[model samples]
Target chain A: MSRKYQAQIYVTLRPSVLDPAGVAVASGLKQLGYESVEGVRIGKYIELSLSAESEADAKTQLDRMCDQLLANPVIENYRFEIAELAASV
Target chain B: MSRKYQAQIYVTLRPSVLDPAGVAVASGLKQLGYESVEGVRIGKYIELSLSAESEADAKTQLDRMCDQLLANPVIENYRFEIAELAASV
Candidate 1:
């Protein structure tokens, strides 16, 4: 049977980029009675499951995907994790 | 004793808003050998702990915060959850 892999990617704007969403969420928290909330930044989490021959191959594919499509090198950055799944008992 | 509240806010770009970060992450996953992965979008999760008199008040404050800071009304949207904590067990 082919091995299954799971990848979780987190993408966020570089610190220099302006994030209006982060600002708004922080303001909303304060209004919701969370006065102590501060310095909120927004990012994305993506989870994917795939079939691969090995962990090394999976990592290579994920890296290429990030470079070609998942992240914009001009303004954003991304990180991903790939894990192999064991067959169900 | 004052009530403690936990709020988690998720922020995302509106459907119409262009997300370069989302695109990058999707591509990254594919490179990592996840050929089946599709339609990846990115967002933010914010966790906050606050003291409030009541759930209603916490909700009100959180709403205001979202409106004022946590989210950018023009390009992004946000949603949050608030739960009260019980005394230490």
Candidate 2:
């Protein structure tokens, strides 16, 4: 039997890493007359649907997925939330 | 006087938009031996810091920011949460 799960992953550049997109956005805001825009950081939000046998199994698999390709460990950090997919009658 | 506020903005593609990056990620997960990946959607997570007079002001400003530049209104929809920045001390 297979159980469904949903995962939301957030991948963000490490604080030490320079984020050009963030810089660009900040400047864009400034240009748009948002003088109070103090800072901005851009990150990736990924929503994934998976079928697994158990919550632990789903988490383990998702973690491996994040490490292998979904996120670049060297330059970014990733965090995720997993929830059982509600059964659709 | 200015009060600091933090806003977390989530920008997601509309249902009708074709997400090439999402397709690529789903396929990549499949190739990585996770065949249970039913679907994937990619979006943007942005963290913003601003100084405003009140929460209402913060929400208004943030809404305008999203409308004007943070997100592409044509293809993407954005939602945000704003909280007053606690005084450091």
Candidate 3:
């Protein structure tokens, strides 16, 4: 039988890519008197749940999902942590 | 001397709040044939670097930053992980 799993995926822009949005936020923070803040980068965080026969199966599917849709491989990198969920009562 | 620290912050909508953007993404994924996907919630992932005297100091500052700017208290919640960086030459 299949088991439930939850994945916390983080998608970030490659370091070489410029993040204007992050810069804007940094400036905003500076204006608010948070002068110590530096080098801010913003990205996408996705929480997804699915079911698979095993942990290996879930990981393989998640990797495919990230490569195909969750992240733009050309300019973004993605990583995720997966954990099996307790079976529902 | 102060040391560098990195903070990974995740901001997500409260469960009771509607997530239209997440719904759109889930539907998009479904169209792409990932039918097993469920409870897809999209959130903001932010990476920030700063200098602080210690880990506790960094954590305190990050908490204030999130409260004031990074997350909305009304509809969203935020949590973070902090790592101390080696001193630069």
Candidate 4:
């Protein structure tokens, strides 16, 4: 039987990279009324689905993609999660 | 009075941009046993804390940052939200 999969990847810049957006948002939050916020960092989330014969194969392919295309090793870092979809139950 | 704020920015490549990372994650999920998964797209999330005197000013500055530095207008898009922290509650 064919199998389906889902993956969520989160990407972010290294702390050293300047995050003007993060700073602006933090400032905006202060205007809105959140007084306890300390600092903020921004990142990315990517979700997708695909087919694979086995979990091990899927992980291997995914890791390659992350290293080759998904993330820029020079500045950005990424993490991902994989899960199976329930079969109509 | 001093105020604290938080901002969360979500960034993603335009649909036209190729997302190899997204594809790999989808494939990985399929291998893990998810047979019903469909397509996936990946993006970014950023959270930050800062100080602001008022909401309007904060929004203005945040928008400027998004347009100027946070997001790459050529390929990526970004959105943000700001909220205040309750005092001693």
The candidate scoring highest on TM-score is 2
What candidate 3 gets wrong by more than 4 Å, as runs, is none
lDDT of candidate 2 over A34-84, digit per residue (tens):
998899999998999999988899999999999999999999999999999
On lDDT, the candidate that comes out on top is 2
Give the per-residue lDDT of model 3 (tens digit) for A1-89: 77889999999999999999999999988898878787899999999998887889889989998999889999999999999886642
Task: Extract clashing residue pairs from model 3.
Answer: none
Q: Cα deviation in Å at residue A22, candidate 1? A: 10
Could you tell me the lDDT of residue A70 within candidate 3?
Answer: 88
RMSD of each: 7.1, 1.8, 1.7, 7.6
Error of 2 at B52 (Å): 0.8
Instruction: Indicate the TM-score of model 1.
Output: 0.55
lDDT digits (tens) for residues B1-89 of candidate 2: 78898998989999899999999999999998999899999999998999887789889989999999999999999999988887532
Q: Which ten residues in a row have the lowest lDDT in candidate 1 chain B?
A: B32-41
Q: What are the candidates' individual DockQ scores? A: 0.26, 0.88, 0.82, 0.33
Instruction: Please provide TM-scores, in order, for all candidate models, with all chains considered together.
Output: 0.55, 0.95, 0.94, 0.54
DockQ, cand. 1: 0.26
- Write candidate 4's Cα lDDT for B7-59 as tens digits: 66677889899888867766765676555457778787777665666767667
lDDT of 2: 0.91
